[model samples]
Target: MEFFNKTGKVAVGSRLRMLTEKITEDAAKIYEVYGIGLQPKWFPVFYVLSAGEEKTITAIAKEIGHSHPSVSKIIAEMGKKGLVAEQKDKTDGRRNMVSLTPKGKEITIKLQDQLLDVNAAIEAISAQTTHDLWKAIEEWEYLLEQQSLLSRVVEAHKKREAAKVTIVDYQPKYKAAFKALNEEWISTWFKMEATDYKSLDHPEEYILDRGGHIFVALYNDEPLGVCALVKMDDPDYDYELAKMAVSPKAQGKSIGWLLGQAIIEKAKQLGAKNIYLESNTILKPAISLYNKLGFKKVPGRPTPYERANIQMELDLRS
Candidate 1:
């Protein structure tokens, strides 16, 4: 109780352990009152062997939901007390089959009547409570099966990190990440051309220094996606949205949508009257996203790459 006061209700494992110890202590007391020298922990193995079938250590461990080592140790103790005996499995020489001895069988018969009294006492305790502890424990076990505590914790951590994603202006440190993200999608869909290599290998020279801007989407300061607004030669308002790609691992987290929105906003701020992009019609998701962002199909323009079948343009002037 003092430990509960210090740790509060969050120490679930500690509280459960305290409850188990208390119940075990009460069971020991009940066995002593009946003049039975058997420990409460040994009951599981004894009950299993009493089923009149010799079971291997592995089988007993599985049935009792205890580790093989723990069951083996308990069986060793029971062997010393003349309550159980082990024999080499006939089929498998490596396995040891266990069964209750004559003394163990006699003890089980004697304790059969005592079991009703112990059950009544426990039921009386449960009757005083508003909720059934056993039912609550069963529900808790089912919920844990659907999603483990570790998985829930990991999902929460991923959400926390995803929320931290920020669209940042390109920096030298992010150059490698920029190339990797773009290359992942591009190479998967189409072979990377010389133009792709030029832009990816030298973003600063080919994009940034050419009166253009590059944005990197970062989650927890790690770059996960990249988008670029390439300045056109004819007019300042004309721009090309190119070299946009998101890491495959970060696909479902909407890193692509984040980068798209960021680049659009950046273009608007920089006096972009028209934004153009070249993509393949086979890239359905990307094309759909572009359409949602108000990009309409436009006349195909001459491009350096063979995969450029679909051309789309977004008019910012409207």
Candidate 2:
């Protein structure tokens, strides 16, 4: 109980289960006080049978919202105690219908006074609570049906994980990670060229020194993604969005999107009218991410690398 209280909302499931066990235990004691030998676990099935409906086992299970096997087990226990009996359906010989036996009907007659008293006690208990548990449970179930606890938990997990990733300005310490992440993706599709190595190996001279900015996505002080907004010498564009890559460990964590958005904002901050990028259509996910970042395919320009086939540009003015 102490541990549950300490955990609070995080232990909601455990707390609810514990609470149900407590209620069931009290219900058994209450029935004992009324001189009844019925098991609290069998109450739901008994209640459905006592309504004077000779229902098929399948129908009983559906009406009571329990598994057929569970209802079957309860009926078997009741049958041994001579509380319930089953017979073939008159219209459907294959269907096994069930109803309360004489003993069960007698118990129902005896339960009327106990039921009224129990109902009053429950009303008194509910009056003591600031919020009604019954209405809250119904509302909570409706909300869960709309967006399940699994989805809400997964979204929270993603948001918390993404929060751990910090976009920081490139440092000399992150040079190796920046190069390794980009090189891994590049080598997976096409061989690296001299232009790639020159920029990767000497980022300060080739990129930062020329008024361009490099950003690193770091999680727990380790770089997980990298991208460079290279100062372009072209007459048409102000920056080249180049060498974007995320570590495999950071896949599905929105690392690429974060790095891309950071670089685009940086380009816009530099008073750039447009951004250019070179790529091949073979990298579908990358192309999709680029397109989502508002980059559109444009006519190709002369490139320094042989793998360059698709050219894209993002108009910052728009």
Give the top-scoring candidate (lDDT): 2
lDDT of 1 by residue, 1-318 (tens): 787889896698889998999999999998888877799899999889988899998999999899999999999999999999999989989988999899988888888878989899889989999999989999989999999988877777666666778999999998998888888898898888999999999998999999899999987777888899998785433889999887777755667777888888988999889899999999998998899888999987778889999888999989
In model 1, the Cα lDDT at residue 172 comes to: 96
Error of 1 at 308 (Å): 20
Kindly report which residue pairs in candidate 1 clash with one another. Answer: none
Off by over 4 Å in 2: 1-5, 35-37, 52-110, 148-158, 171-173, 183-214, 228-244, 248-257, 267-318
lDDT tens readout by residue for model 2, 1-318: 789778889889988998999999999998889987788998888888889889887888898788999989999998999999999889989989899998999999887778899899989999999999999999999999899999999888877888889999999999999899989989988899999999999999999999999999988878999999999888898999998998888876778889999999888888999999998999898899999999999998899989989999999998
lDDT of 1 at 192: 83
Q: Estimate each model's TM-score.
A: 0.60, 0.63
- Report the poorest 10 consecutive residues by lDDT, candidate 2: 248-257
